[model samples]
Target: MKALPITVIRSIELLGLVLLITVLYVGSSIIMPVLLSFFISIMLLPVYRFFRKRKIPEIMSIILPILLLALFLAVLVWFFSSQISVLISEFDQIKKNVGMHLEKLSKWIESSFNYSATEQTKFINEQSNNILNSLGNILGGAMGSFSNFIIFFGLLPIYIFLMLFYKNLFLKFIFTWFRKEDHEKVKEGLKESEEIIKSYLLGLLIQITYMTILLGGLLLILGIKHALLIGVIFAILNLIPYIGALFGNIIGVLLTLSSSQELSSVFTVLIVIAIVQFLDNNILMPRIVGSKVKINAFAAIIGVVIGGSVAGISGMFLALPMIAVFKIIFDRTETLKHWGVLLADERPKDGENMI
Candidate 1:
């Protein structure tokens, strides 16, 4: 075989990378529904196992969880719908307060920076339109998909049921398809991936609960109305990381301003969110997630951003778990463990050995 020129080699490498990314994008779109069903299955598996280990009938285990999950989802939908209705009913006041807040903010910026009021207003107007238009775009496609939305919704539960039933067989198939020498490694990888994903999901739920309690307590002390509503919304939103908390706080402050028009209230909400973020970043994540997922901070943030860019909210939520799964599988392979290690943040020091 003839040796390729350096330029040709570089071109080939770039082409390969581009092709790989394109395939990944296409594959994600094609397999996203199946993956989501599997994600739900993974979450329910532990509960199923907990019951099965006690000699509970497998059929009973499946029926119980599915029924409970359906009830929980119904309650969640009702709660969000009621809260959203309240907000929509108060939209007039909200619009007024928002406009007033913008005026105050523009003036404050001008006074602080010694800029012309006219220039500040112009800048604010330009920025606000861009923000609003972009928001409209984000929401534009959402409401128009009624038929498709119903179809997807109708399929989800059925998919979840089938996924739970077939999960073990799927795992066995994966192991059997691999070489005999790699069977143990593949099995271990699958187990680790399952544990990591389950832990991450549970950690997320725990964090949301913590944030709700913390934020709710603070808001109550600060005499904010609808404290529970705002706190819960922010807590759930905070799950998406950097942008999520920011979005949550922005909405919280807006609600506070509309309800009271008190700058101090807004400032307090901002501080509460900041403190919660600090604790979450430094404390909650490590203790809850346990680092076995093998995603580094930089990659985690970048993955979230890319996910948000591609699939919006769902993407942001799935990005880290997907990356963690990749890391887990990669780590199980001798040739790929180095790459997986690079993806991991925590490493043992001194004479410690990692399993």
Candidate 2:
């Protein structure tokens, strides 16, 4: 065989890596929902335990949780459907008032920068309609793909059922994989992982509730129309992490300015969103999530981004918790301790914070 050049060999290696990544991405798409279903089952563990402690059979305990989960999902769907119908009904009104909203924004920018209203208008008005139209088209196409969505949604029950049924089997598999000498470490790691995920979910749920109520009240006080609807929407979105709050803030401020065309309302809404985020980041996250799932903000953001990119919204929700689980396992393994430290919250050694 002829000798290959080093550069050509390296190029081939890089190509192989790219191909591997592509395959991995495709696999992740199929596995994402399964992982999501499992995570959900994990979340229900507490409730399952609660009922079990009350002398309920394991099977019956699962029944209440399954029912409760269904009810919760149903209510969420109803709320979103109702709100969306209202928004769609008002679309013509919103479109008609776009110019007024843009004008208000232009004036504010112009005033702040000491520029002409016309100049400001030019900056804000450049293809804003075109962008909105493009977004509408994309969203409409996604909405039309109901069959595709249905396939994924229908898979949920199967995934959920399997997880619930084989929960103990799953645990046993982990334990059995370890050497007898390292079994203690495995148990400790699992315990830590459980606590971390529990705290993270609890904290996030509590924070989201606060965001809904606080933002809704702020919007109401600011005289924004459909404050409750927007508030609820933002709150749900806020669960997705960094990008969610930013998107929510933009929508909230735009809608506020659109209705009132008041610079003060825009500023007020922005301030309210900022404060809510501050509380979520500082007070709520640290206290609620605690040091349970230790992870740096950058790593956390990357995890969410990867999750979002992989399985979209569903991926986004599962990404962080999944990362936390990996971190927990890493923390317990001697070889992986350094990597775990990298994933951990970059705080003091004496004590750490979650937020």
Candidate 3:
């Protein structure tokens, strides 16, 4: 039999890729949790191995890591909740400040547009009523989704445990997909992918810690209210790459405006955040995350957007590591190396990491 033409094969590959993406998007509710669990399991592998090394029981090894993860999340939630409660207690003040700002904004709009205050009030009332109607529907939808969130959270640990327990089975499943001669390459790809995932996740945790400290501490010193809350929110949002940092800036500015009487506080917050982001991007992130993932800015941004479209915020956070893993596998396979090249940044300079 004659072999297929290269163009035909390429076309087929593209078709398959599109189909796979469609399936993933359509089944994201099921797939996203599985993917999240896989990543979490991989991150916890080291802890699991450490316990296993000490001849600990397999169940204990699994439970320990999950317990630690739960404790960390609990503390984080408690801290943020406490800050949020403080903010909530100041809701009346925030509302007053917001009303004052809105009135000023309304006056400016009225002057510029020659719109009467009565007309503006009518428009505002109509819009507010529409928004309230939508809000009820949104709340109803949210209530439905809250159960899904509970299921996802509850299943995550169980999935992690199963994945860890059946690690050898997954390895066998991967190996069985390739020819015997290609097993070595597959093994190498798996190792590289695991290292990249572990490194990337750990680096993010470090980034969050330092960013919270630096941003929150700086804001506090600068006399910004809800400094820690702003820092924590920004740091978490910063996980989404370029788009996330922009949103973080917007959120920080809004928080500043709500709590601050001085307009200059907005500028101060923005400038401080810019400096902190610069230091992180230029100095801190490079040292921490390094070039282990090897993804370009364009690819990273595209990944975030695609991920967000497919799986919301969870997808955004998972996108980078997922792409990195794909790149690793693609680069290792000769037929797919071009795809890997497309995903990667320009080659790093000799002995230098390009993050």
Candidate 4:
């Protein structure tokens, strides 16, 4: 058969990409949990293997890891709930502080802009009403999605268990997809991908631990209220790459502002976050995570935005690892090697061209 023109082939590939994305977006509710479970299972693989090597029962091996995950999550929930209760108990103080800040802001606006205090109050009330309405709509939507939240979590363990239990079968199934001669390459890809996932996931856990300790510890020492809560929130948010850190900073500042009347606390929070983030980005992350998967910033950002668009926060969180896995697959496949290059962070040497 005559080969298709290069443009035709490229068009076909682009169309396939669109279709795949459409499918992912449309079926995200079903697909997100599976993807989450897959990653979780990969992270837990070593634990499962350790138990298996010790001659533990297969069922027990799986159950043990899931139990460990559950216990950790439960403890996290307990801690947050406790902290939140404390925050709630100080609600009166927070309300007063917020009112004071608003009054000061209103006065400043009136003086600087020649706006009357009455006009400022009226404008504030109008904006406040709009914000309240938006919040109400958001809360209603959240309540509607509460069942989905339950279902997602409820099915996660089952999916993980099944995936682990039938992992060998899945491996055989994957091997069957390629030619016998290509089996070695496929095996190498699988091994590399597994190492990448494990290393990336484990590195993230370490990052979270140190981030929480550093941020929370510093804030605590500085006499910041809800220091631990801010630390925990920022650490988890920082999982989403560049965007996560921004939101983490904003939340840290907001929490600090709400809890403390002093504006200096906001600056303190920002400065501490900046210093910690610098250390994390420059030193800690490089040492801990290394360059197991060297995705360029552009690709990482785009993947995160697309993932978040398709599947919300879960998508954003999973985007990097998913992209890493795809890069491995692409690099191993001759036709898709270009896609891998596109995702990679490597720069060309002088006189060296990618093509």
Candidate 5:
């Protein structure tokens, strides 16, 4: 066969990329749940195997691991609900604090920028109306999201159960997709991808635990109100990589400021968050998550952005693992190894130019 022109080949690749993205976006409602369940199922494989090894029935083996997962999620829900309830009980105080801050801010603006208080009030009222309209839209979207969440979780256990029960059949299907000579490479990819998903997911769980403890504990000791709520919010948001931490900081500060009139408390929250995040990014995460996936910062950020654009928060969370799996497959294929290199963190050798 004649070799295709380079431009034609490039165009074909680009077209495939576009089609794949479209499918992911269009089918995200179905696909996102399946993907999430697949990763969770992989992480629970050992637990399932342990039960089976003990002569447990197949149904019991699957149910037991999923029950454990449900228990963990239940605890998280209870914790957040309790914290948020307490926050709600203090609503009047929070509102008063917010009003005081607004008055201070308006005065500062008037003194510094010569903006009249009446003008500022008018501007704020105008913006508040706009904000209220946006909030209504957000609430509507959130209702749809909540319904999707129910459906996602409703199907999660069933998907995990079926995936576990049919593991061998799935493996057989995968093996049949490749040539006989490529079976070893296929097996290697499956094993490596499983290990990566398990480690990555478990590492994130540990990260969330320690982050909440460390940040929440410090804030509580420093007498910050709603410390646990702030901790929980930041810990969950921090899962989205670079952009998440920034939002976490903003939220942490806002929570702190709303609950207290003292400026020092805001500074305290910021300093503590900065210190904890520094430790997490530098010391804890590196050791906990390790460098198993080896995705570059550029690739990770882009993957997160694209994933968010395509499938919202769930997509962003799944992006790293998906990219890792892709890189593994790409590296194993003769024609795609260069694409794998592009996703990796490997730097050029000394005296070598990237080009």
Candidate 6:
């Protein structure tokens, strides 16, 4: 029998990828939670091991790590709640500031471009109504989905616990899919993936701490209000890679504009954020997270976009480590090694060897 033509093979491959993406998109609600639990369980493994070494019961060991996670989450929620209450109290003032800024902007536009305030008010009103309508629709949809969101988050700890409890069973389940000869390779890949997940989570925790201190401290020194809130918000959002950082910048600007009396303060905030991001991307993040993940920037950015498209915010946060795990598996399997190379950052030995 003749082999398939090159074009046919390429077309089939592309079709397969499209189908895979479609499946992921359709099943994201379930798949995303399970994937998140898997990673979280992996991150808790070291803690579980410590308990086991001290002669604790397996069930208790699992519960201990989960309890710690719960405590951490509680503190996070409390902090955010307090900060948000502070913001809510300032809402009236913020509204006044916004109106003043808008009036100033309208005047500038009228003088600079010969646009009348009447026309500006009409345009702004029209756009504002449209935006409000869109927001209403979005909020209504969110209310409908709120129960599912609660269920998703509520089930996460249970899922994590079950995953940790049945870790050995899952290991056995994995090996059952392959022959004895391939077991070692699969085992090695699993170990590497575990390390990658653990390191990535720890690195993120470190990133958040330093980023909040660096960004918030700088802004506070610069006499910016709500500096800590802005810092914390940006740090958390930055978990989503390139897209998150851009959103963080927008949030920073909006917050600065609302709180600051001078327009120069907005530019100052942006400059400071840019500097922090530079340090993060070049010096801090590379040493902390990048070294552990070993994924190229191109692959990371694509993964983030695809992940966001498939599963929104959760997908974006999970993308990098998930890709790294896939790369580990691909490299361990002989047939898929080239795919791993494509996902990696190392420069190819020769230009012509590019994937």
- Candidate closest to the true structure, highest lDDT: 4
Query: Which segments of model 4 are wrong by more than 4 Å?
Result: 131-136, 349-351
Give the per-residue lDDT digits (tens) of candidate 1, residues 1-355: 9998968865885697478556656665445556666777788888888888989988787766777778877986798798788879988887887788878887888789988889876887999999997887667677665655676667777888887777778877887789999787787888788998899888887887888888888888878867878888898888886778878988887778887676888788788778877888888877988765667788889889877766556678888898899787667766456657767887669788765
Of the two candidates 1 and 5, the one with more favorable lDDT, higher being better, is 5
State which candidate has the highest TM-score: 4
- Give model 3's clash tally: 0
After superposition, the stretches of candidate 6 with alpha carbons farther than 4 Å from their true spots are 1-12, 132-136, 349-351
- State each model's C-alpha RMSD to the native: 4.7, 6.3, 3.4, 1.4, 1.6, 2.0
Off by over 4 Å in 1: 1-20, 27-29, 54-57, 106-140, 145-149, 346-355
TM-score of 1: 0.81
TM-score of each: 0.81, 0.79, 0.95, 0.97, 0.96, 0.94
Candidate 1 contains a number of clashing pairs equal to 0
User: Model 5, 93-139: lDDT tens per residue?
Assistant: 99999999989999999999999999998998999999998998999
Better of 4 and 6 by TM-score: 4
Give candidate 6's TM-score: 0.94
Clashing pairs in 1: none
What TM-score should be assigned to candidate 5? 0.96
lDDT of each candidate versus the true structure: 0.78, 0.77, 0.92, 0.94, 0.93, 0.90
Which ranges in model 5 have alpha carbons more than 4 Å from their true place? 132-139, 350-355
Q: Global CA lDDT of candidate 4, please?
A: 0.94
The TM-score measured for candidate 3 stands at 0.95
> Of models 2 and 3, which has the larger lDDT?
3
lDDT per residue (tens digit) for residues 189-210 in model 6? 8888888898999899889999
Candidate that beats the other on lDDT, 4 or 5, i.e. the better one: 4
Candidates 2 and 6 compared by lDDT, better number: 6
RMSD of 3: 3.4
